[model samples]
Every structure is written in C-alpha cells, then in structure tokens.
Target: MSVRSTAFIPAVFKNLTFWVLIAIISGVLVGHFTPETGKGMKVVGDIFISIVKVFIAPIIFLTIVLGIGGMGDLRKVGRIGLKALLYFEVVTTFALGIGVAAAIIIRPGHISRAGLDINDASDYTSKAQQAFDWWEFFKTNITLQALILAIIVGIALNYFSQRERIVATLYKISGFVFKLLKLIMWLAPVGAFGGMAYTVGKFGLQSLLPLGKLMLTMYLTMAIFIFLILGAILRFYKIRIMDLIRYLKPELLIVLGTSSSEPALPNLIHKLERMGCSKPVVGLVVPTGYSFNLDGTSIYLSMSVIFLAQLYDVHLSFTQILTIVGLLMITSKGAAGVTGSGFVILASTMTAIHSIPMEGLGFIIGIDKFMSEARAVTNFMGNAVATIAISKNEGDFVDREHSLNIE
Candidate 1:
C-alpha cells in the first residue's frame, strides 16, 4: 500500500516536521530572550537523545544479524563491507578537498584573533593529547562493537540448522523495537527545542557576528558538497538526489533538530527499507557509514585546519595541505560515537602538524554548536545515499515508487 495522504490542514498540524520547525523557532526565541531558562531546558533534549540511544545497540544488532542471516552468503557480505569502506574513503576525500579549497578561497581566518575566545578549548585539547588507537576506538565505540558482533552472529547463524526459526524470532523482536521507536519519536520536537535552546542560550546569536564569515563559508561549502558532489553520486546511480532528500525530510528535520544523527539512525534504516532497499544493504551500510563515511565532519575538520592556519598567518605549503588530507583520511574515522570528537580530532591533527598553534581551536568554539546541525545532517544524508548506491550495485534494491506506489 502507498503512504496515505491527508488533507493539507490536518497534515500540517499533525506533521512532525512542522512541530520540529516550530520548536526550533520557539527555542531560538527562548534562548535569545531568557538565556537561563533556555540553558535549563538542556535536560529535556538530553533525556530524549538518551532514550533513543537505548534502542541503537539492539536495533543495530538485530537488523544486521537478520539481514546477513537472510543473505546466507559470507562472501557477499564481505564484498559489501569492502565496497562500503572504499566508497567512504573516496567520497570523504572529496569532501575534505572541497573543504580545504573553500577555506582557501573564502579566507575566513583573515579576521583579527583578538576577539576570538581561546579559554574554552582546554578540555578538548587535553583529550587530544592522548593517542588514538583502533583497539581503543573499537573498545570505546559501542556501535562498532555492535556492528562487528552482529556480523559474527549473522555469519554464524547462516550455518545453523534452525536458522529459519531464529530469524523468525528475531524479526518479531525487530518489529517490536521499531514500534517502540516510533512512539519515542513523538518526543522529537521536545528534543529539538531543548537542543536548539541550549545551543543558542549557551552561545548567543551575537556570537555569530564575529565569526560570520567562517560560518557562512562552512554552510556554503557543505551546500556545494551536498548539491554538487553528493548529488552527482546519486544521479550517477539513476537516483534523483532531490527525490531521496524530499523522501527523507522528516528524518532530516529530526537530525537538524537534535544536532546528532544517532537519534535518526533507526528511522533512516526503517525508511530506506520502506523505499525498497534490501535489509542487508541498509543494515550493513548505515552503521558502518556512521563511523567511516562522515562527509560533513571531514569537510569541517579540513576547513578548520585551513581556517586555523589563515587565522594564525601560518602558511601551509602544498605538501602540508596534502599531508593534512592524508592525516584526516585516517583521523576522521574516529569522529563518530564520541562527544566533541570533531574538536578532539582537530586538536590531535593540529598537535601532529606542529605548525598551526593548537590554541587556535578555541577561536571557533563559540560557533561550533551552530555548525554541528549541518554536519549531522550532511553525514546523515551521505549514509543514506551510500546505502541506496550499494543496494543498487548488489542488485538488491527495488524502487518503491514503482513497485509499492510509495509516492
């Protein structure tokens, strides 16, 4: 059956996106007028994100396990994983290059550093001083751990004599998890309100004036990457980028509101499956992409590096720029599943470069929260596109608009 359509009036009021938009506007007003009250609203957002996170591990485990178990092909599973990693590497490299190019052209760091705040960066800097280890990353990243475990369980189940029964049981559990997730999602507007309020309350809108150029550069660069680079990739696969985006509007709104993609992760999987992407492709790609395919974060980190060099009047040679790209190729994978990881990754990269002053990080701290929504949204879109592309590549996709009258 096709998705049911309601009359415009009832649709607008009942729509989650409409409420989220209103919440975001209300949050801005609250934060701008009464900063203390806005700051206090943080718990409302935090609790919502936390409640959503409760489903993440289980959903990842169940979905991936079920997908792979259904596939019953160990070799195909490995191939999809490899292809996904390869796609992530290539696209993120382009994202980094675009970021660096934009920063150089825009020259956002030309403003005086005297007005930039440097005190707030101490926490991220201290965290950056510690080395990044894959083992440590795997240990700390519950998502990665869940992904790996799911693959193993899925592969193991392929050989089980009663695999069909186990899969049937797991499918029922999966249905229950998603139903609960649907109910929990009604709190998204509240979460969005709290998130926006906390951000604006903590860092007032006036703060954007001083670093407006950098903020503009960031948003502009991401827009280019989304429309030009990512758009091309989707188009090449015979998929309309705008169509995919419009279809994902609700999840995108949730991500924009939360400034954290995790809240939308389950929904993305559910929606992609609804769009006729195979369970295996969505399950395998989405969680893996969260860690490896952070298009927005790559752009931000690359631009931040260049922005810092320009801010400090430190000239980066062509070779140094390449080195930054190469370094980020490795470092950006660590961006997911950690709080303030973007800053932490930036700090670590700067420390390794030893040319740009590590203190420059504090300069952008005021507006980082504002940019995070964009980062999360871009990352969310990148993962979705990746899933669809991979699904088509594996001959595993069906266009729901044609088959199920999804439109």
Candidate 2:
C-alpha cells in the first residue's frame, strides 16, 4: 500500500468526528432494535459526563486566572464581563420573543391534552414558587462559582509581584488538565452512543409522535434564531455564521449526542482561542456566557410556557404574554446551575403567571430529552458567537488567516 493511502486510513480512523458520528448512528440502531440493552448504556454516558465534570471547575478556574492575570488589566476584565452580560440579556430577550412568536404561529399545544402522561412536577413548581436567592444560585452553580473566584483571584494576583510565576505555574497545570481532557475526549463516542441509546431505548421513537409539533417548532425557532438573528449579528462583524458552525461541527455533534452543552464547554473555550479570540475574552466570555447567555434555554422556556397555555385551552391576553416574557428575562438567568433547569424554569414561569397549569409539564417531560439536543446545541453555538463578537467589539480579536480554513 502507498504511504499516502496508509496515512489517510489512519487519519480517517483517528478522527474524533468520524467516531462520534458512527457512535450516534449505532446508538440509534441499538436503541431501536434492543431497547433493554440500549438502556443499559446510560451508565457509559453518565461516566463520561462525570469524568468531564471533574475537569470543568479546574479548567474554568485556570483559564480565567491565566487569562485575566496575564492581561493585567482589571478594568478590561470588568468591561468585557459587563459587555458580555449586556449582550446576553439583549440577545436572549430576542430569543424569547422569537420563541413566543413561533409558538403562537405554530400552536404546538393546540391539540388534545387528554392521554398525555402526567408526571410529578411538584418539585419544580415548588422551587419556582420560592424567591430566587443569589447566594443559593452561586453555591449551586460551580461554573459561576469558579468564574467569580477566578476573577477575584485573578485581580488580586495582578498586584502580586510573583504574578508571572504563578501564571506560569497555572499555565502548566492548564496544559496538563487539557492533556487529560484530550484523553477523556476519546470516550466521547462512547458517551454519545450511550446517551443516544438510552434516550431512544427508554422513550422510543413513538414517544416523540405526540409532542412532535412542539419539538418541530422548537427546532425551527432555533434554526431561525441562529440563521437570522445570530447570523445578522455575525454579518455585522463580517463573518459567516455558517463558517463558524462548520468550524464547531465536532463540538456541536458531541452536544447533540449528549443532550447537554456542559460537555462541550471546555472545548468551546479552546476553539475560540484558536480562532484568534483573545484568551481573556474567550475565558471571561465563554464561562460567563454559559450562565447568562443561554439563548436556546431562553427560547425553550418561552415556547414551553406558551405551549402550556394553549394545551389547557387557556386564552392568554397580549398583556399576559408580555408578562411571561418579562418574567422569563429574570428566571432564565437562574438556569445556569440547576439540573433539568429548562423544565424548572418553565414550571416556575407557569407558577408565577398563575395562568398556565404546572401539571402541563408532565406532558412534555418525556420528550424534553430529545428537545434538549436542540437547546444544548443552540446554547453552545450562541456562546461561541457571543465570545467572538465581544472579542471583536473590544478590539481584542486577532484575525487569523487559518480561521477560515476548516477541514
């Protein structure tokens, strides 16, 4: 065999994307044919997520510390953070509006509510009824906690005479952690396989048929948001959203399989830096954005609320619709750290409005996992775009020639 052919063979076999795609397909097939076996694969996915979570806190801490400390500009750090927050709010609001509009147009909930499975949503409803506590949010949110501590430590280190030494030490640690992450990422195919298999096995494809309209509307709204709203934003920067999406194809697939964006967080930060976004910008914006700028979650939350209203044949006035959007602006921000946060936020929003039945959550709970793929993927892409946009706006972005050269 020729050397080129041998090399090509190895490259194809070694590519992460290749394996992950294959895994996803295999998983679906397994789930469809042998659900019992497929359901067992959840452990594989859980282990992968646990392993990934182990690195998340340290990586965030190290990246933020290194980025901020290296920059030695406390003011710039604050400015970048503030700007990212403002951008997150405005864009997420737009997402909420789009979701509401799409839900109204599609009316995914206009069908019969009878025969829908009703699960216990009391936990989410009760939690939503309570006042949101910032301390509780920070305590539960590891990434946000890491971001805050890292920022404070980074700022303090800026004044330390041995800041460079500390930064260098942290850099080495960061490299080691990334190396470990690279090793762990090889399990992504396994993780994806397990996650997909479990989801399909447990829920079955037939499960999606009942709520298919809501799912379709959710996906459509996300696509529109990405192409129209986010695309226009990227165009303003003279960049192509398609190019960026293509660049992050691997990460997006990982999120697609896992149905959670958390797994892709570290890689997203790394990719943004490689794309010539400043380290400080990537570090500060990405982690913070994970918490504050959940465009997908915002959309899902808004659309779900409207769907519930329609499901129960409850007529919502324009004033009530605006009230839901307003309430979501605040509730959505709390989604960062909570598990099953989308539903929780939905529950909370419904509870607060007192118009939508909280029990309606039970109907959508079964298919939330499938829809989550869209939410996670969109949230992941939104943050990626936000990081680059903020970097460009701050004059910290470096236009690398190779950024457009995606394989």
Candidate 3:
C-alpha cells in the first residue's frame, strides 16, 4: 500500500490542472495574509499574459491562411464565415435575454451601496461617454486585425501559383509556434497565482461581501446558461457538454485564475483542432467569436444595465427593455478581450439610456474583478462550443479517439 501510494503522488503532481488549482489556492492565502506582496505580484501575471499574447497574432494568421489556402475553396470559406456569424448572433441574443431576465427577476442591485468604491470606475465611465465606434473597435482590437489580414492573405494565397510550396513552409513554422506554445504553457500556474493574488490583495475579499447577492446571481445565471442553453445546443449535435468541459478543464482553470480569457485563447484554438474541428473552422470561428460572439460579456453587460436600473428604482417599460437588448446586441460586440471592457460597454449602455445613474456603476466596480473569472470561463466555454457547433454544421467535425491526445 505504501509503495502504491508513493507511485500515485508523482502522477498527481504531473497534471497541469492540479498545479494550477494549487497555485490559485496558494494565491488566495497569500492575498489574504500578506496583501502588499500579493498586490506587487500583479507584474508576474501581466508579464505572463504579455508573453502569451505574442503568439496570438502569428498563430491566428498562420492557422487561417493554412485553413483557407489549403482547402482551396473560397466558397466554402464564405459559407463557414456566414454560418459562424449567424450562430454567434442567435446564441448571443439568447445570452443577452437571459442576463437581462436574471437581473430583473433577482434584483441583485436592490441593496445599499454603502462603503462600495464607486470612484474606481472613472476611467471606464469616461471612455464609455465617448461614442462607440465600430471602425475604432476594429482598428484597435489586435485579434480582429489579425483575423482580417489573415482572411485576406488566405484568399490571396489560393490564387498564387506557388501556393502549395508556400503553405508547406508555413506549416513547418506553425509546428514550431505550437511547440513553443507548449513550453510557454508551463508558466500558466505561476501566472494564475499572480493574477489571483493581485485581485484578492488589491480588492480584499471583505470589500466584496456587500455585493455578494450580485455575485451569486451572476454566477448562477451563467451556470444555468452553460449547462441548459449551451448543453441543449450541444445535445442536438450529439456532443456532450460535460465531455467538452472535462477536456478543456486546464484551460478553464487558467482563465479562472487569470480572470481573463485571452490567456486561454491559443490553447482553445489548439484544443478545438485536437477535438476534430477542422483547422479553418477553428481559426476563423474562434477569433471572430472573440470579438463578435461574446456570450459571457453580453450576459454581463445586459445584467449590469438591469441591475443598475433596479438599484435606482428606475422603472423600465417593456419597450425600453427591448430597446436595451437591441442596443446591447451592438454595444457588447465592442467589449472584446480587453480588461475593463465589460465596464466600458456597461457604461456606454447606461449613458445611452439616460435613465440609470452612471454612478451606480461604482457600486459594482469593486466586485467586478471577482466576477471576471466567471465571465472569462463562460466566454472560454462559449467560444469552444461555437467552434464545435460550426464544425459540425459544416460537416467538418470528426470524432476520433486520438482527438483526446494532447501534449
């Protein structure tokens, strides 16, 4: 028994999920016990995210170029793009409705805002007052920029006489990039630790207690959406949601610890491909979904608006509520993967409505960091589901035993 137990310990230590989970727990303890040191650890997480981000553009460019160029079918590319956009629109609309519905029913904002920090929201609110420009959003979002350039280059590559040779070379580079990504991923636990520590150290858990109801409401709503709405959709495709969640557990934990989905973007692309989603579908759908198909951000945006309205006792008519949903369908697209973007989008929506006091935002700002983990995880899961759905719809999904093999 002693020999068997000793052998099992090394296997447990080898799992990335186990390490990441331990890091998160350790971070919380540090933040709670030694706040100043935890706050300074923010640089660790930031540096890690910055390092991971370096690969995002090139990976996206190569993957899309290879996916489209290799396929040699512009028509199919157009078909997949159209289907993905349509899927994003339909699913996100439901997400918006669910968020708004949950907020109204629960009325989490119907509480005292005493002692909550409202001043921390100034930067986001100031940005929100600026008119949301679709052109600017596209210009500033590096992921979308990479995606557009890749699509154009991919289409151009198909018409090149020497396309096959160039694609072969690009494939070799792609292999190196993914290999490098595997090595970089070893730091995920460290990054997770820093991110969690910074959040808890800076905000302190006690500061968030007053808004526990809002936190609970948001979490429960997202859980329901994931298991019920997303699960039902996957069921129709004969895919199990639990299976996908289990497969993506490591990535999800990274998102949870980091409180940002961008950390998991590259891994999601690789994992979706490993799950038998065609390269083109994974490349095109995943990046596009980051900007346009933000299920969790949409939910957060809609819910925040309703929570604010209820907080101030502002009565929103059915028509106005519908209008809010319609507006959010556009505004939420601008949130992207940027930190504090959700707040900016929420502020913009509040500004446009002219009813809810923008100051109400201050009430929730302190707790947003804690809630971001939930949002990021949901967003990560949502994008994964989107990729799989589009792949299956295009008849590009292949279920294979080897699909589960990931280094």
Model 2 residue-pair collision total: 0
lDDT of 1 by residue, 14-99 (tens): 88889999999999899999999999989998998889888989998998898789778888988998999999999999999999
Q: What does the lDDT read for residue 254 in candidate 2?
A: 91
Ranking by lDDT: 3, 1, 2
How close is every model to the real structure, measured as TM-score?
Answer: 0.94, 0.94, 0.96
How accurate locally is residue 216 in candidate 1, as Cα lDDT from 0 to 100? 92
| Candidate 1: residue 239 lDDT (0-100) | 77
Q: What is the lDDT of residue 197 in candidate 1?
A: 93
Q: Model 2 residue 229 lDDT?
A: 85
lDDT of 2 at 239: 94
Candidate 1 lowest-lDDT run of ten: 398-407
How do the residues 81-112 of candidate 2 rate in per-residue lDDT, one tens digit apiece? 78998999999999999999999999999876
lDDT of 3 by residue, 141-225 (tens): 7887888899999999999999999999999999999899988988999999999899889999888888899999999999999
Best by lDDT: 3
C-alpha lDDT of all candidate models, in order: 0.86, 0.86, 0.87
Q: lDDT: which is higher, 1 or 3?
A: 3
Question: Which pairs in model 1 have colliding backbones?
Answer: none
Candidate 1 at 216: error in angstroms?
0.8
Error of 3 at 63 (Å): 1.6
- What are the clashing pairs of model 3? 118-362
